[model samples]
Target chain A: MISIKDLSKVYGDNVVYSHFNLDIEEGNVLCILGESGCGKSTLLNILAGLTPCEGDIPKLRTAYVFQEPRLVPNLTVLGNLRLIGADEDAARQMLASVGLDGLASRYPRSLSGGQAQRVALCRAFLFPADLMLLDEPFSSLDLRLKISVMQVFKRLRENKRITALFVTHDVDEALCLADRIVVLGSGGIAGDFSNTPSEKYGGNSPLRERLFALLSGN
Target chain B: MKKYLAENAYNLAASLLAVVAMWLVWIIAYAAVGNDYLVPSFWGTAEEFFSLFAQAFFWQAFAYTLLRTAAAFLISFALGLVAAALGVAFAPFSRFLRPIIAVCRTLPTMAVLLLILVWTSPKTAPIVVTVLVLFPVIYSQLTSSISGVGGELAEMARAYRLTARQKLSKIYLPQIAPVTVAQTGANLSFGIKLTISAEVMAHTYTALGGLMSEAQTYYNLPRLAALTLCAIFAGLIIELIFRLISRYAFAWQRRAEA
Candidate 1:
């Protein structure tokens, strides 16, 4: 479990967050859902200790997948995977899992956007970390690629039960991927919900409607 | 296949045209001067070139000069890599090195050669001068490229807990290889030229520059021109070899570009 308290972040004249606090349970997919510039990615960066913030964050080994793939352009797909200590067989298997088989020797520049992102995802998964951070990873992906990528994440999550903090503005992405959803607004938590089976399958979940209202500022 | 052949033929024609132009200029100049000592006939210079090729002393001189240049170049290359690494790892040290790099960049190669000759023996002076002339160029190139390795990749490396060696070989080298290849391509010829120039100034015993200087003293214009042409041929051959090696070394980049 990770706990953050009294987080305050400011950049010159712009105030990003003030007295922000969050708690995430272990082995849970917690999505920080928000609109543009709602401090979602900033929160992730703060948690990762990349950006300056006054807060108490739990000491967790973290793997981050940025909005861009951020791959070494000169390295082949498998080479990038091996950087994180994945061996040849494991790297190849991971690539195949993301539908990128036979691309082990291809450089990042040679890969399509979707394929590159999948490589980034594989890199994140291959790293030995207690927590994973994703920043708008599927935002630039097409619908089909997004779904396939989501499935990749789903399969990995099911297999490893790795704790994750996924940040995004997409409502459907949060609905499909997160075990718990935390909506951020006005530099603080606006709505927080934990999903249950019936809430996902039953006629119309109040949680979904409430989340929509909260997101739209109704 | 036809297009490729046509391209090759055109290239050959262009090269021949260039040679013909040079020959015409040499003939015209020789005709105007009417003195073999001042302006050798193209045929006379050509004959000297062939004769020089047959001489063991010429090959020995060429080989010795090449060996010295390669030694100096390798030293410069190694020191430059270390300097760049130190600069990246420590900002204060990098700041300390900037002025020295600037001086090396701006100082005349001849002046540096003379200064080096005062301390080093004539035999080693050329090597020292070559390093001085080339170190800043190679160091600056590597430092800038090393610094430009993105923070994102660094962070990624950290997240993965990559060992220092892993980070260097996997991330730093891959990122820096292109710029390094480019700088090496441009500087290799310059390094060779500087080495020969330094050899001449230092009065090195077994070098093309020494032979050229000797020819100049005796007014052996044809022999001088022949040696000069040999130097040009050496530079061209070295450059071509470097290009081929770089293409092979960074083949992944070519693939990505393709």
Candidate 2:
């Protein structure tokens, strides 16, 4: 249960947002979809309380997956999860979910890009936060590794029933991972779509045509 | 082979040129003066040097001086590392100690010497001065090494909620060791010069400084030259020892650079 009203962020002479609004219901996976530099991450940081912007956000425990892994370089894969108060078993399970089961003792520098980002994801899941924020956490991943991480996120979503706001420039990623998708354009919140992946249609169904038409005001 | 030689060519050349220039100067000056009094002939100094290598007393002095230097290094290193660790973990307390460290750093060696000479025995005077002069250098190096570890990793450690001791050994310690080891050569050399100089002044019986002093008093120019050259050789040995340490203790650095 999170809500934002009339949120705006300005940096020097640049205006990232003016009166931007978002409402996240419980157990919903909402993604802020946008092109690069559309301030999706700035909005996520604001919600994480890592940045100050004009808005009143509901106070709740939150975990964020930054664009980079942001895992502690010195810590082992398990250790990062331990930071979020995960116990030995929960940390192991979360790492296993991300296919990092055997990497518990390895440091961030020792991990591959995808593995490190997955460790960051495991950290977020392990935190037991009511709200999760992901800012293009999978951007650096290749197509093969990206699918595995997406599956891990899907499992996390199914289990936690936690409200989440993931930001990404890729529409396909937004489609596959989100329960509801909000497209942020030059004006912000250009289109909001209810995404439902079922037995009938895979959520990974391409929305390129519809989204392009929608964004272009066609 | 080419890359290896290319990398070290400058150092090798410079070292060779320095030896050649020193040899040339000695030969020309000895011939021109035609006197062993002004500056002993290179052959005379070399003979003294060769002769001293077989002398038990010379070896004993050399051994004692080296042992004291090693002892001073170890003691000062531990003190410096601990103080730095405390400083990094608790900045407020460190800030409180900052002025004290500054006073130690800036206080005159003569002042330290004159002050400590009052209490310590003549034999211990040089060791005490070495520790005092070296303590500041080492402590200051540790302080910077601690600070140079920077805030990002520290915050990461905090988020991990590491225990006080865990934070020190894991996050803080490794990051600074390479830097601390780097400061060792400069600090050791600093300590060596001061300690040996003090030894010369205090006339300690069991020191290389005492040997130099004895040479000066007896007008044994060859012995003085020989001892001076021995000190230089000892210094180069020290540098080589630390270079080997740098290779191992800072393996992470070697990896990154490689």
Candidate 3:
């Protein structure tokens, strides 16, 4: 389990998080749903060790999928994967898994938005990280592209089952991918619930409604 | 291959046209001046320029000047790269270098040459002056390029736990290569110009600047014009070589553009 206790983060006059505590179970895909500027990204950054906060945060090797693909422009697709220690065959295999086969030699500039995001996903999965921190990885994509990329992400997550903290403002994304849904508001986690088997079936409607209400309340 | 050859041919033609335009301007200027001592005729200067190749003294001076310029450039580049890297790695160091780089950038080259000549020999004065003049330029270029590696990429590297060697080879070097190459070419040419000026002032007898000084004392305008032309051609050749290196070294950039 990954634990964050007594996390206090402040930027000058603004307090992003104060004494915030959360425990993430192993192998659980925790989706953090929040409105804009509700400390969603800050939380993920804290987990990724990119941000300094006053807390007892577990130190774990993390794979990050940022809002942008963040691939090195000069590196080929496979070369980018190889940058983080992915071998040639394994990188090729991972690229194929994300439907980016035959693009091993292609640079990031040649890849379309959706294709680049897929490569980012491939890179994140290829790295042997104990935890994955994804901050709105599909936020920039159009709806059609979003759905396709989300499907690719879902397939990767299912295969690896790495503990992930997926931060997004999209309710549908949370419902589709998250094993545990968290709604962050001004005070803290306004709502938290397990999206169990029953919730995936008929219970989804009420759960979605409740999440929407909680977000609007914020 | 056809397109590449056609492009090269067009560029070569354009460059020739520029040279012709320069000669036309020189011919007009000579006519306006109407004095051989003031503005030697283009043909006379060209004859002198070609005849320079046969003289052992001219060759020796050319070699010495070339050697000094190269020495200054290599030293300045190395110092700049090391300082820029340190500045990038440490925020306080970057802050500390700000004022020093500012002073170096604003220093008067001739005044600094006078001071350096008083302390160092005439042979070494030009090299020192060129280093002092070009160090800030190379440092600023490298610092900007290194800092421009993008915060997103750095964060990504950190998150992925890329080792120091990995970061340097896979991220920093490739990101900085294009800018560094262009800056290196420009600085080298500028270094040669500054070195020549210092050599002229210091009266370095075995350098191109000393030859120009000799021509000036004798009022041999044609030889002086010829030496100046040699400097111009040298600058152009250096720029072209670097442009070719930039093209081939960063071929990935060209492929991306295509």
Candidate closest to the true structure, highest lDDT? 3
RMSD of 2: 5.6
Model 2 spans > 4 angstroms off: A1-64, A70-173, A181-218, B1-14, B32-34, B86-95, B249-251, B254-258
lDDT (10s digit) by residue, model 2, range B1-258: 698689999998999999999899999999999978778888889999999999999999988887778788888888877887788769897888788778777878766776778898667778877887788778877877778875755544443345777767666776666656656766676666676788788887978899999899998999999998888788777777776687675433441322
Q: How does model 3 score on DockQ? A: 0.55
* Candidate 3 C-alpha lDDT tens digits along B1-258: 787778799887898999899889999999999999889998999999999999999999999999999999999999999999999999899899989989988999899888888899999999998988889989988988999999999999988988899899899999999878877777888888998899899999899999999999999999999999999889878987897788788755754544
Ranked by lDDT, top first: 3, 1, 2
For candidate 1, write residues B1-258 as lDDT tens digits. Answer: 687568799787898999999889889999999999888888988999999989999999999888888888899999999999999999999999999999888888788778778887877988888888889988988988999999888876775667899889888987788667656756767777887888788888889889988898899999999998988888887776767666677756664544
The 10-residue segment with the lowest total lDDT in model 2 chain A = A197-206
Which ranking of candidates, highest TM-score first? 3, 1, 2
Q: What is the lDDT of residue B49 in candidate 2?
A: 97
Query: What docking class should model 2 receive?
Result: incorrect
User: Could you give the C-alpha RMSD of every candidate to the true structure, in order shown?
Assistant: 3.2, 5.6, 2.8
> Highest DockQ: which candidate?
3
Best by TM-score: 3
Each model's C-alpha lDDT?
A: 0.83, 0.77, 0.89
What are the models' TM-scores?
0.90, 0.71, 0.92
